[model samples]
Each structure stands twice: as C-alpha cells, then as structure tokens.
Target: MNTKQLIEEAVSLPLEERAIVVDSLLRSLNQPESEIDKQWANEAKRRLSELRSGHIEAIPGNDVFSKVWDRFEK
Candidate 1:
C-alpha cells in the first residue's frame, strides 16, 4: 500500500522480474515532451518528406547491412 511496502514487494521479485519492474518505473518517470523526442520527431518528418518528394531514395536494408558488415569485418 505504502511506498516502503511496495518497494519491499518489488525487491522480493526474481532478478529478471525485478529488472523489468525497475525499467518500467524508470520509464514512467520520463516526460512526454522530452527535448530529444521533439528533435527526433522533427528529423523523422524531414526524412519522410524528402523520400516522398523524390529528393532522396531509400536503400535496401540488405544492401545497407551487407556494406556495414563488410566494413566491420575489415
């Protein structure tokens, strides 16, 4: 019921379950209008607009990953 009791119950959970609870609690503390989210949203819209207008072309995922793997292997 209280914060102390809730914390004690969480602590009694298995290690993996405790990690999930801690991650969920931490995520709940994040604000909706976080600065990074706004920046990323703007960037995503810009990329989408460019793609739609034929200003840029999307590369195949397999081609991109193959190039990356080749570079890393060297």
Candidate 2:
C-alpha cells in the first residue's frame, strides 16, 4: 500500500511489535561504523605491535588492583 497506509498500520501495532519492526528496518539499512571503531582498531594494532616488540611492561592484574586499592583507601 501507500506510505500513509503503511505508517497507519505500523502505528496500530503493539508497542513491542512496533519497536521490533523499527529495529528490523534500521538493521536493513546499509550504514558505516562510526569513526571511533576505526580509531579503536588502529589503537589495538599499535598496542599489539608494542607488545610484540617488548616496548611496555606487562603488570599483573592483582598488583594493579592492589595499587588501586592502596590509593583509594588513603
């Protein structure tokens, strides 16, 4: 049917059902990820390279948490 008819039918749906329809429509659209995704991937690669080259010290999680708690308690 026409856009107006389709919209009226959609609006008549239950709230949860309408939400599902909207979600499906959004997912069907072709969209690119945000710039932050690209930046995150690049930063992850850089960190991996640094780890491979031994450019940074790897601290244990327990030690890190201990230090955090020490400072937090003071």
Candidate 3:
C-alpha cells in the first residue's frame, strides 16, 4: 500500500496499538548506540558504589530543584 493508505490504516488502530506503532516508528528513526548505553551504565554503577561507600552524599531532589529555580529567578 501507498503512504496515504498506510497512514489511514494506522489511524484506525486502537489507542494502545497506535502508541505501540508510534514507538516502533520512532525507535526505527533513532536507533540506540550500544557504546553510549554502556558508558551510562558504568557511570550509574560508579555513582551508586560511591554513595554506598559514604564517599558521596545524596541530595534531596526537591532541594536541588528549589536551588535551581532560585538561581534561575535571579
């Protein structure tokens, strides 16, 4: 089928199915890079290890956002 016909068929799908179709199309256009994913995983693991070992302290998300907004308003 042509593009117009394909779109009409997609539009007739149920809401959940339409969402899946949109997600699949988006993933096809923007494929993930395994190297970047691996780096992020390693960084997350390092941060968790530091927090667990008391080498770093976690800040409350609310406090962090409040500080950011305060600075932004200034």
Best by TM-score: 3
* Per-prediction TM-score: 0.58, 0.52, 0.62
Supply the global lDDT for candidate 3. Answer: 0.99
- Error (Å) of candidate 3 at residue 18 is 12
Give the Cα error of residue 42 in candidate 3, in Å.
0.4
lDDT by residue (tens digit), candidate 3, 1-74: 99999999999999999999999999899998999999999999999999999999999999999999999999
lDDT values, one for every candidate = 0.95, 0.92, 0.99
Structure candidate 1, residue pairs in collision = none
Query: How do the residues 11-59 of candidate 1 rate in per-residue lDDT, one tens digit apiece?
Result: 9999999999988888889746778898999999999999999999999
Error of 1 at 74 (Å): 1.4
lDDT of 2 by residue, 18-70 (tens): 99999989867956577977999999999989988999877899999999999
Top candidate when judged by lDDT against the true structure: 3
- Looking at model 3, report the run of 10 residues with the lowest lDDT sum: 25-34
Candidate 1 residue 62 C-alpha distance from true site, Å: 0.5
Give the range of the ten consecutive residues with the poorest summed lDDT in model 2.
27-36
Query: Which candidate, 1 or 2, would have the higher lDDT against the true structure?
Result: 1
Could you give the candidate ranking by TM-score, starting with the highest?
Answer: 3, 1, 2
* Candidate 3 TM-score versus the reference: 0.62
